[model samples]
Target: MEVLVSEVVGRGTVLAGRYRVLSPVVSDLAGASAWQATDQILDRPVRVRILEHGAVAPALDAARRAALVTDARLVRVLDVGTHEGYGYVVSEQLVGQSLARLVAQGPLTADQARAVVGEAASALEIARRRGVHHLALRPSVLHVSPDGRVLLGGLALDAALLGDSGGDARSTTRADAVGLVRLLYAALTGLWPADPRAPQTPGGETLPPAPIVNGSPVAPADLVPGVPNDLDTLCVVTLGPNEDGPHSPGELVRELEPWGEIRASVAETATLGEPMTAQFPPTGAAAPGGGIPVPADHDDQDTAPVTVQRQSVRTAFAQQDPPGANRPGTPPPATPTRATGLGPVPSDAETPPTGLPLITPPAYTQAAPPPPVVRRPVAQATAPPPPPEEETLEAFGFNDVIGAETAAPTTRRFDPTALILILVAVAVIIGVVLAFRALFASFDTGASSDTDPDPAPSASAPAVADPAPEPTAAETPVAPAGGPPVIASTTSIDPSDADGEHQEDVAKAYDGDPATFWYTQTYKRDDFAGFKDAVGYAITLTQKTTVSTVTLRTNSTGGNVEVRATDAANPTAGPVLASGAFGPETVLTLEPATETQSLVLWITQLPPAPEGGFRVEVTEIALS
Candidate 1:
């Protein structure tokens, strides 16, 4: 049942003036009606997810926020609005199958699992940074693009439509993070880790839920063989890692990035997708009555003189090995820009393939190796050229010689002793070459003693440690010598307002999310009405990182804020590092930079809110 205030719209029903519903009706996760529809306005296909009218606010806000995530692997949200009493979100349609349909057949190969889940994790992590959470990330919401790219759908709107995201920001973050690891487990073992007894899993119901014991999911390795130790540990540890808790999506991406397309899965191609070219062949493929011209009898058809017959494109590609793919130390051959030997089509390939039209490819010539230059005797004016049969030894030997031709036998041109001198000179030259070769052979055999490989290192040898894995580029600053502050956590502080609950929201300001914000309590006056001097939030860094500047992006302009170096999550007092009035963006600089584990952002004065009270909403906070 749709949230239609009027009559139910079936197939071919137009909604929101342009979308013509094509899918009859489908229900899942959100208790919503989903349809495949054609956008008459754009003249293209689109996916429309329709929910009840009550979910309009959250779903619309979530869709708008999710639209700000600019990753190619994320499905684009085209429209979000109300039609009649129903709220709907329209997104781009995918031509390829979803991971649900793919996994329905069988478990994916390890490479496919990693790539699909890895790319999904990457996109969701990017979405998380934008203050949008796909609390419902799972196989069904993940799709394979036509080019094999795995894309994530329903970034924020899914959870909104499902009504599963009423938790605070921290809980929502953890839910999304844990959801990513669970997806990895499901992709690997074909068993979903989310509790089976729950009404629904993230991204809706798909695979059979994993077996549970004592409130915990079973490890994937217990069911699957050859699952890598690292991946297995990643899946299991997140269920319970350490005191630090479940792993975040950023953490998952670090582990998953290296194994991209780790192994080939071409054997599952038929189950994965239909060969796109077979359904619609290339241009000129369906010519009538042998219309394609045969280049065999053409004058320029002789590409190059060759002793061997040329193979068809298919046969040549089958034999071509990837560089360093097979035997080691063998040099790779040159790959051609275009395939050759398509001239008249082979005698064995005259018939078109069944159901597929033959594509008569354009004719092209292959480059040939150049002939070697040779020195030959020149014919004299008085003499005829030497007979072709006795011409010269140039064709048979690697030697070059010059001489003149004559009509008759001439008197000896030089003394016979000259030949003897020439022989002596050749012998001396050969002896010198042999002597150098013997010398180099002695050097090659004799040079080894400085650093012996067999001996173990002494106890005093300096320890060599493995390099730490590099985090994704977004998390780390570009130049670390004196760069951005690496913040660890945040909390709001208001000693005067004892009942004020702001812990969950202090994080939103500096969370790298552009949509969320941290705001102060509304006061009747522009300044706190004869209350405490200020109310603000504090930032705890990963370590004692230096800070040269603090930047903020806020919805409320002209409000006053101060930066303070402090150790308190709930600071009562601290030394001011910098102070300034807020604009659309505000930057506060500290001379010579300060190194510390925690810093505070104290808001003293508030800007007037649109309705009545004075308040401030800081969208983002940055350190550099």
Candidate 2:
């Protein structure tokens, strides 16, 4: 690939009708250049990389393959195309300082460095799970956000088109792990090892080659003193010439994860000191008392020292003389000494003055009970004479309205026994219904036997009856010979090359509607000339059953189909059971075998359709 003149492409140059180039970001040694661009249609920023003319189609395919994965840590390839003599790939314009730029300023702290590399490792793990290998990872291609976020750009497509690397997937992954360790080392020591394979900066500046002595890069311990022993050892071992380094990014991530946490804990522990309360002086200057102020009546009941509140007079006296001072005419104070119960006060002792006199406790004695009071009767007043009353009732009807409604009949109390009888009757009815159901189940089995002697007897052709095995609970009793089989689930391998949104047609075929169907895409030849083998439809029975026959109804039959029974959802591993050329309507009687859960209708060969192309349309399928 030859480099085009720089003047041919510059700022404001537009390519592929959608991406308008804003400015040139970088130019590779192979004449490939990446530019900042804008997507005119989507109204978003994009990065457009122009490659040699011959590499357009392959790069475009690679870009489309990379687009299948959606991860925020990687720059997304939006579109790829060729215009004039150059191939251009439009990618999401990343907004952050490149790792190269970040390192140019200064080295990162161990925590920051680990965070960047760990995040990158997680992204690599995701891509690896998705079957994507980033073979072009380098510090220059990596972007760092203000908040330690690492984004890996420069996808493998770029490397593929530029012929930068020839390593396979395994080698690529190992190289990525090595790249991460190198990035970490650079972040720690601000010295990047020189490697021709490492991606170059936009200005095409390479990192200073690491000073190597005795077949190994000089250790970070010799350059930076306080680098942790674990970190230094990890860097040395990972970058060592021996094949003992981590082989994958996950291995590196696991080894690094604990170091960051352990370092953080050590730093935190070193910063911790005595509690603020403990730092305070034990005298009154700390608080109103020697320690935290407590309510007067508060008590912990423990032997720990307590802070007693001094009264105003005591405080004043304490300031004058903390211990009781002896006055000139007070016969001096009693000597300040510990006293025992048998000892007398010393002549020169100093004793604390008491605020109030102590009173002796009262002697224990039983108190006398109070006497009961006697009530005196007062003079009684004379009562008035009783009033006269009439007890006769008045009625408007005959016989005095039935004797005044029979004394307003007494209210009746509820009887719970009637409710209990009703409940008993309901229980008896339910028991009878269950018993009848049990009796009718036998009749159902007899009816099924009478109708379906063989589970899958063909209509157009007679099928040989298979040995009737003992029925199991999982066997769904076949309905009659002509009835549809009970289906629990339906699945199909709908090749994407079909008319309209045909994947939904898979459900329509199993819906038992004669009007709807699932049709194969028109092919140039009968055997799905351009498609892979094993393109088919599958139906799972409601239970594991020995299918006797399968009947297919279709408007057009342009393929020889195979009917297979297997316990696996995917029947690709084994040979199909039965196969024959199908007409407009076809019936296949299966040989009696062990119960199978799934039945597949696969296309083995194709014939020309009536409409002049090779296709098959199946409207309905019945299995019994």
Candidate 3:
């Protein structure tokens, strides 16, 4: 049953009992269609994915489940169920347009691209924290909303299906990062890596060349013009072939420091210290009674201590004194008489001029004893030998006090043993110095010997001895006259061939300008176990003109199918183009703008129907 865009719009009902269809968003060749819908339970807008009737249900289910566990950046799934023999999935509705669409509109400015990179890095960080790896990341899968929010969606779980689950999860993330680097490179340079001998489609068909212009590779600065050399280096380093590029999103975010702002408030807080109310501050309204005051000036006088006696005297004077009782209208107490050391009675005569007190002397008595001494006969004691006269060091030509000699200077006579030891030390030092000199000399000699004396002669010897033979005009191969025009192709499958093998599956040529032709293919295969039983086909195009652009399109006969573009000569050249779910039909346009001799098309894993094999067909090819 071929489903027309009109028919899908006509069938207005709840899909899978969860999503109520609103309008068709897009459809691709894998028979997968996206529709705007409202979730019954959540009451939120969601996108519904409806697989073709004969597509593999289990594989789709597996993918949905893996997405739920793997990536936080993916749109959340609300429900999954079958309706009218077709599988449908309810997912969160994104409010954004694909990055591809943005690029098509216009290349992003440097600042705009940087902002997008930050958002993408943040999203990837979230995924990394959750241990989810997005195996599929392309411009088409990356979306930017009207409000400038970036979202990443569409995860591929083919490896998970094959059970090669070891460190592949990490590898998958790195691979996706590399792919993003390539995409960024392409965006910057408008060229891709060269592939001249790529493989063709599984059938005898060939695909056009990639859309890359010229044979030039992209430079980081070209994509985001005016980027600093350091930033460019960082991008290259992060996207380099190192196994430890960045294991987590946080690490990746660190490389984007150029975009982060320096928070002034945070810096001020750090400098001023923590809030005063937090466990510590001043304890008084102004200065505490006994507490030290903060100095207003840098002088020590402000905080210096005064003598205690002076302080006490000042305090005593400050106290109030009692009134005197001796004279009328006068204070009773003045200065204390005891303190003045004056008598209590008043003197009748004039007081002495001095303010000192008069004192009386007391009489004293003493007893003395006297003793008589007899003359002693003193034998003349011989005076000890005159003590040796002190000889001052100064007398000996030295200062005595400053340089006193504690002992006599004894002449040190060198013994035979000491003399031999001295000689041995001198010999050892001489030997060591000579040995080091010889060692260094040898090292220098060896280094010089290793280097060729005439480097130029040695380098040019082979080239000069055996020069390349000059080519004769007759022996040189000349290109065909009027050289082939570049070929371009764009394909979008039709609903009629939704479940049948595409006509373009077989090798074919077109009568167009051979410069601008679009090619399409469709296929249907029943009995697929969601993983196996894939539909395989090839497209071959003769070199009527040098092919430039090659577009591979796919639509599911029943369910959605994954599409990948690779070198037709070598299938492992790695997919140059890849995407998820070509619903009814999706177009992949390649325009290399260079001469391509031939091209091949390849398709695989067609959705299987219970009744019979699904069908697919290619619709158009444009060459110039």
- Judge candidate 2 against the unseen true structure and give its global Cα lDDT, from 0 to 1: 0.58
> Compared with the true structure, what per-residue lDDT tens digits does model 3 show for residues 514-606?
332332222122323222233333233344444444443333344433333333344323343433333334544444343334443433444
- By summed lDDT, the worst window of 10 consecutive residues in model 1 runs over 275-284
Clashes per candidate, residues 3 or more apart or on different chains: 0, 10, 86
Top-lDDT candidate index: 1
The model with the greater lDDT, 2 or 3, is 2
Candidate 1 residue lDDT tens string, 501-613:
24557778877888999877665566565445677787888877888899889888777888888755446355777889987799999755788778888777888887776
At residue 475, candidate 1 shows an lDDT of: 35
The C-alpha stretches of model 2 lying farther than 4 A from their native spots are 1-8, 53-58, 161-166, 195-203, 258-624
Deviating ranges (above 4 Å) for candidate 1: 2-6, 166-168, 196-205, 241-246, 262-624
Model 2, 463-500: lDDT tens per residue? 23432233444344777432334788766653321212
Ranking by TM-score: 1, 2, 3
- TM-score to native of every candidate shown: 0.42, 0.41, 0.34
Q: Which ten residues in a row have the lowest lDDT in candidate 3?
A: 271-280
Worst 10 residues of 2 by lDDT: 274-283
